[model samples]
Target: MTASGALDAPAASRPMPSLAAFTQRLRDRLIMQEDPATAAYDRIMRRLGISIGIAGIIVGGVELPEVAEQGRYAPAWWTVAAVVLAFGWYPIIAVVSAVSGPRAIRFVCGCAAMSFLGALASIPFGLKLHTVDATTVWPFRVTALAVTAAVLAWTSRVTVVYLLTAATSAALATVYTVSAVTPQHVTENFLRSAGLAALFVWCGTAATGAAARVDRESAIASRRAASQAAAHSRDRERARFAALIHDAVLSTLLEASRAGTKSDVLQRQAERTLEQLDECRGAQRDPDLLDARSAVLFLRAAVHEINPSIRFATRTWPGYDDLRMPVHSASTIAAALTEAVRNSLRHAAVPGREVRRTVTATVSAGSIRIVFTDDGAGFDLAAVSADRLGISMSILGRMRQLAGGSAFVESQRGEGTTVTLVWGGDGSR
Candidate 1:
């Protein structure tokens, strides 16, 4: 954590975090703070509901009618069963459609439930069981099938599920029609049934695919809205940090300079610390920068709405997040880096006695380091005040907060000043 070599290890050093881990962490944080048992129950209940919807579809659509009507002695209970499902299926399954994960599950289940119920209602010549007149029972079947298709299309937002349920529904309908005509036209019915199933599959496939595409677009729009909200929060935190620097630290530094008690080195260091603090979004903001001793490569694109200019020119950086430093250690290191960058920009002299000035950042071994060097005249190092707020409140103060780390300055006349920040390192990459 404190060395440069440890932080900038090559990619082969250790395995990177996986997609599973990222999603798992997200699940943990967004848990809605419910009791463990309550959450488990909710998840299970939703799954059960989905299962019931699917089961009702199969029983009503295919199994019940085939078993009851195929035998010469049809049961009166079968007609009663179909009618029961026709009226109740849609509203009962509607409760399960509210399940959240994947968002498509409930929709698919609901559509399937309605289609199955429709199949039940369509049992032809059902009056043969003496349950009702053939005319009355016939209308129930047609109306039920149409209602199920319409319900499936209207309720399930997922296109794939809609098409699948619809295709299955249509296949059931065509096959039933061919099978039920009073005088069995067995060969003609078989060919017509097969052809109808194939045609319905194609039509449903196209229509359902279109619906799925529309759902995908809706998801993208929602993500964009969430990102904008996070950016606003970061801006507010930055403003709060800036206020602390201006009101408390800057005022004291100015007073020290006026009293003629502060050394030249102290004044210069104070100016530098201010620069780093200015760039900071501070502790509460998701890390703008971190210690590199863990030698990690984080793709900035994954983080929502980070500064475009704030980036890694170097491929590898030290890691000190949940993977390494405990909460306290990471925070201490964050503060140190902020001050190091601040001091460098304020007071670094030009290197090689030239006038061009630039700040370069690099992480190596167990340290995430930034060097602010310039081609300006440098001053004596020993004459600087150790107690200067910039040095005491910023650099050394930050290092002292960390368990094992240090901040160092190296400078020479007519050369430049370089600030080095070091942190504790781990054996792993």
Candidate 2:
């Protein structure tokens, strides 16, 4: 067995790794180590949270004096504690959530809930929180609207309804807390506070929803690309296997049948066919690259194996002998060329007519080209059936599967036939 095969056998038989192998994965993500699956959503949420936190800090700083002035109407300790809870906690949590993970997000949600509840609780105690009068507006009232709306941005529709209900109730309570409540005052304050909350809700929901959709679509596209690559790889392997059977095993059987079972040439060919099959079974390692000289020699041996009488020639440009290509490309071209020669040998030899077959391989700095010509009983290319896999799958499809590889066939009824295979520069067409 090959070294790679020996190593892979043990790995393939081993059990899957335990869940403990991934324990640090969450910690890594909390520190901003991105997971490709949720990268888009995480990026959007991180930026949104940081922006809202910064905005909250700015609003809190601007409203500090008013908050302090309103403290006279409430207990001194309650006023200081409420200010910290309503204004200080959430913004810090929101900013830290960018690196802190889901618990920080939950804390921000708690802050939103507590701010609305605190406004309602202060009414019975004569705290006058969230009250709007001729001279002053409650600072907590304004900042609470922002904090609650920020939560709504990332929450579900059901939670949105619940939070909005709490906000509306708080707005109504603040209106009643005014010394002389009027229908006009209640309607105006209710609409202003609730309307601003609704606007933030709508904007936040839309932005977050769009970010989620982007992440979903990106994951789908990634899966589809991977599936397509796998399918192409499978198709290439199938083509290579089919070519091997057609060129080596079948050809050996035909020669053995024509020459007698006891023939030495038939025995040798059968042994070579068995060795090729064994190699194919273990061909799991990465293929080695082939330089120009090595590729030419390999092609010459391949052609001679099929038809010893066929003329073969090689032409290499100066300073291009060191040019290299993937081994798969070389193998694909060799298989296609051999298939073309087999087709010529089977169909071109007419009774009482001399047939000449030649293969020419040309190597340049950026490309490799091979031409196969036969001066024999040529057939029309248009009359060939689509199901004739010798031409379609083995020769054409095989080369087409290789990157930057192509094949062409040209023939006329009374003239000659030419099969051309190319790789690299100008081969895409």
lDDT of 1 by residue, 1-429 (tens): 121212122322333257843543333222222122133333333444444455445545554554344433345665565546453453355343332321343454445446444544455545333333221233223332333333334433443354444444544443454324342333443344334534533453444445555545534533443344334434555566777688657875776767766577667666766766665534344532223432222212211122234333433444423233233444444444444443434343232332333334455444444433333333346644443345554556667666666677665433444556555544222
What are the runs in model 2 whose C-alpha is more than 4 Å off? 1-33, 68-78, 128-132, 135-154, 260-263, 282-429
Error of 1 at 189 (Å): 15
Q: Supply the global lDDT for candidate 2.
A: 0.63
TM-score of each: 0.25, 0.52
The number of the candidate with the highest lDDT is: 2
lDDT of 2 by residue, 109-186 (tens): 556556646755565465654453433236425634554445533466755665566566655665555556667766
Worst 10 residues of 2 by lDDT: 1-10
Q: Cα deviation of 195 in candidate 2 (Å)? A: 2.8
